[model samples]
Target: MEQDPITLIISLAGGILSFLLLMRFALQLSQADYYNPISQSVVRLTQPIVGPLQRVLRPKGRFDFATLIVALAVKAIAILVLIKMSPMFASAGGSISPLHLLIFSLAGTLNTLLTIYFWATLGAVIISWIAPDSYHPAPQLLLQLSEPLFALARKVIPPIGGLDLSPILIFLLIQIVQGYLSALVVI
Candidate 1:
């Protein structure tokens, strides 16, 4: 798991940017409070890139494809850079084919999105117990972002004894999907 400094920097920077852009996209889709400070920060941080793309992409309904596209591109480029720098890849004497890059890009993007949901759902569950009625933006945003997934889980496994078990199901589902993606991508 040794990484060169340059690779580490690229991965860290790209991951953060991708995560933020994904957050913006998710928040928009979830229709989270636009005025929430966290939402505003995500929007502001991503606007420079998403604003221009929005002009061409034109959002449809709650889906903001531009932000998602940018997030994918960022993750793709970072993976490409890291792959190019890897001695294992270099030693194989193989150039990165476009199709392989596309697969890796998609797998990486989906993985990041799932990771975001995983944490958001976990946070929302904790917040529900600690301060269910708190007006804090973080809890509110987490709850907003996670509600859809929670709803799905609730459908299959309703609350027992007035205790919701949806978060557990959602966590299991996320892990299963991530595992499948890892097996499919092989990178």
Candidate 2:
């Protein structure tokens, strides 16, 4: 039941990279200001791989499929490596079905993606209350990233008594979807 240092390192590195890639994908999807320092850092970190991938996999509309693909691949590789190193997996003969691995990776990717939005939505709500008109790149980026989800929730929830409940609704929906995705993983 003891954790390995190498496994921890791999997990941390993979998770950070995957999050950055997903951010790049979301920033493009949201049409976020590229000049933002955070956006610039994400693009700079991922450009090495995404730049080349873009040549073969051009973006569809506002969706950056290249960044998404890299994120998913990174998640999959991280999961695979961790599973191989897991004591439980070793005890079980270290054999995972390809289908199971695929499902796990996809579920992990989606879970992480939703997690990004979950925090973003929460951050936007807090920022709106704290500094509704702030021009800072971080706040602006959060608002841009979360507006789509809030819009969707607004359609269903709407404002009541001058209190917007979109963030609460979006939070509930994200949690529900994330739970369902987690259920899809067999291992």
Candidate 3:
């Protein structure tokens, strides 16, 4: 948790961008309705960047491969910028390795995105319990985003008594995966 100005600026700005990009990436994957306010806003916020990247890195089905690249690129750039400004680099006579930073960025990006999905899935479960029929875009998006994960969990353990336990079960798995990815960053 470096609090230096450079680190702070990069982290704050980069984190917001990364989160937005991640949101856009998930929405793209879920085939969210663009007309929906939340989905439309995400698209508007990310279109300028991902739109151009899409030209070069065409999508596959409902997947926005371009959004993935842009999100990863944003994360890598943030990591590189932070590394360039770190006191460690100065102490090490500016010999920091780009490869190491790149690895960190990739791991961090994956971890963050997974964490987002974890929360989104939990939100979906909560929403399902509280208001399963809500027509809001954000809630609907969460359900859509969690569908694939829930399906996996359903495969392992089917719902009982009109209750879906996949969310709780899957949430634990997400935590395990997040920890694993974070450990990879250290390596």
Candidate 4:
């Protein structure tokens, strides 16, 4: 069945906001400097939502995965609520099972997270390529953000010719996973 336009729009907005919040939290947790005006503005805008989460889900050791978890939770909840309310507010011509809704929400969150990872990784690679000598903040931030994903990718696909093919492989893997998860929900 075709999705309601209003519901689809709301769901997309919620997913995007949640993803930005999560990415900002991740960037901060990585201790990347928000030196640029744009970066600082993002931090300021998202701080209200993320500050409480950071307090509640305080880091234990060196890493802080709480932001990521909280962000995913927020997106999942928002998507679930939108799905549940869609039937009441508008008709989509077909019924969506609760399990399907849950899976779809999960797939949405995963897709957002994977997209952020891909962009951040790509940004890092680009910065490294362009400014090998310059002391830029974006490159450093990107490297820090991409490290975890690249680490995981390295185990499965090693680098070739001093260039890391892990991010590309990881992006493909994420897309495949998202497709599989989406099929479980809506196909």
Please provide TM-scores, in order, for all candidate models, with all chains considered together. 0.93, 0.92, 0.90, 0.68
lDDT for predicted candidate 2 compared with the true structure: 0.87
Tens digits of lDDT, candidate 4, 1-187: 8887877777777766777766776666555566855468767877777678778888665445666666666776676667566666357644566676666666766666667777888886777788755666566667778887788889998888888888788778777877776654321
Candidate 4: 10-residue stretch with minimal lDDT:
178-187
Count the clashes in each prediction.
0, 0, 0, 0
Give candidate 1's error at residue 9 in angstroms.
0.3
Residue 151, model 1, lDDT: 88
Give the Cα-based TM-score of candidate 2 against the true structure. 0.92
State each model's CA lDDT, in order: 0.88, 0.87, 0.80, 0.69
Record all residue pairs in model 1 with backbone atoms less than 3 Å apart, i.e. clashing: none
Best by lDDT: 1
- For residues 60-150, what per-residue lDDT tens digits would candidate 1 score against the true structure? 9889999999988887788788888888899876368888888888898888889999999999999999999989888999999999988
RMSD of 3: 2.2
In model 2, pairs of residues that clash are none
Among all candidates shown, the one with the greatest TM-score: 1
Error of 3 at 82 (Å): 0.8
For candidate 3, write residues 111-179 as lDDT tens digits: 778877888898998898899999988898888888988888899889999888888888888888887
Off by over 4 Å in 4: 1-5, 28-40, 62-66, 84-102, 155-160, 184-187
| Segments in model 3 whose C-alpha atoms lie over 4 Å from true places | 184-187
